[model samples]
Target: MRGSPPLPREFRLVPGRTFVDASVLVRLFDDDEPVRQAAARALVGDLNGPALVVSGPVLAEFAETVMVRLARPLAPVAVRRALTELSELTVVSADASLVLAAADTAEEEELGLRDALTLEAAVLGGCDRLATEAMRHGTVLRGIHVEDPAFGGNE
Candidate 1:
């Protein structure tokens, strides 16, 4: 799933880093859809802005999808390296608090557990923006701003 304009190394992200979802994450490496991949590249490689934030669960979900690609599964070492590379962003671990908050988010937002988990992770990470293709673009989740970077929205 590796590609040019690759996920950066040693990138530093502050608390306000925009949270990134797995939808964009997968595109950044997989080349599944060229249009989406370009969008992901544009968003991630926008050097003038802060690096997007990501979390443990987000990377895990991304990994699960990438490891079982229809063409060929990623090697374990590649998966491990990808996870490590993703951790360069501001990442909140999926711990007891996050899971509990996700439960609440699911109940309140009427979202599935995975979606709720993604949103809750953004909130807990102190992010003000969420970059994803999952939600209605530009809709705010409570106070967190949500947008689809794939559609040219800047996080």
Candidate 2:
């Protein structure tokens, strides 16, 4: 019998490091898109140990996108289960400070509202790296580093 296969490099989940963005989470269930597939694979491969961090805004966005854009409606029971799983991961609440920071980043970096929110969440969570494929390289939003695992570069 074969032993369990090795995990992906991106899924290591290093403790006290690396903040996860909604893009990565959305991909896990989005098989129709190529980018999503890559993101899902990376997370499953390298992020088994570290705490996956997200914000209230991220969760809301995920729910809306999955239900509306994807036209995939999850039952209320399933939604609750998903929330429970997300709670086990690191979820940062959106306080006044976080909102202000996100707003500022959005203005300075010209990022969309959702992207700005994600950036703020990553910073508030003390994440050294923000994993995403949404933004381009060298895109600095209040000093929070945006990284794309699939592309293997920092934004």
Top lDDT hit: 1
lDDT of 2 by residue, 1-155 (tens): 21223334553434346667666666666767777567656764665434567778778776666666664666667666766777677777887766776777777778887788787677667666777778774455555566776766442
Task: Give RMSD (Å) of candidate 2 vs. truth.
Answer: 10.9
RMSD of 1: 9.0
List ranges where model 1 is wrong by over 4 Å: 1-16, 47-50, 70-72
Decoy 1 TM-score against native: 0.80
- Report the lDDT tens digits of candidate 1 across residue range 24-119: 888877655889889887877773334467888789888987888625567779888988878877787788767777777788778888888898
Q: Per-residue error at 125 for model 2, in Å?
A: 0.4
Query: Judged by TM-score, which candidate is best?
Result: 1
Estimated TM-score for each candidate = 0.80, 0.74
User: Cα deviation of 131 in candidate 1 (Å)?
Assistant: 1.3
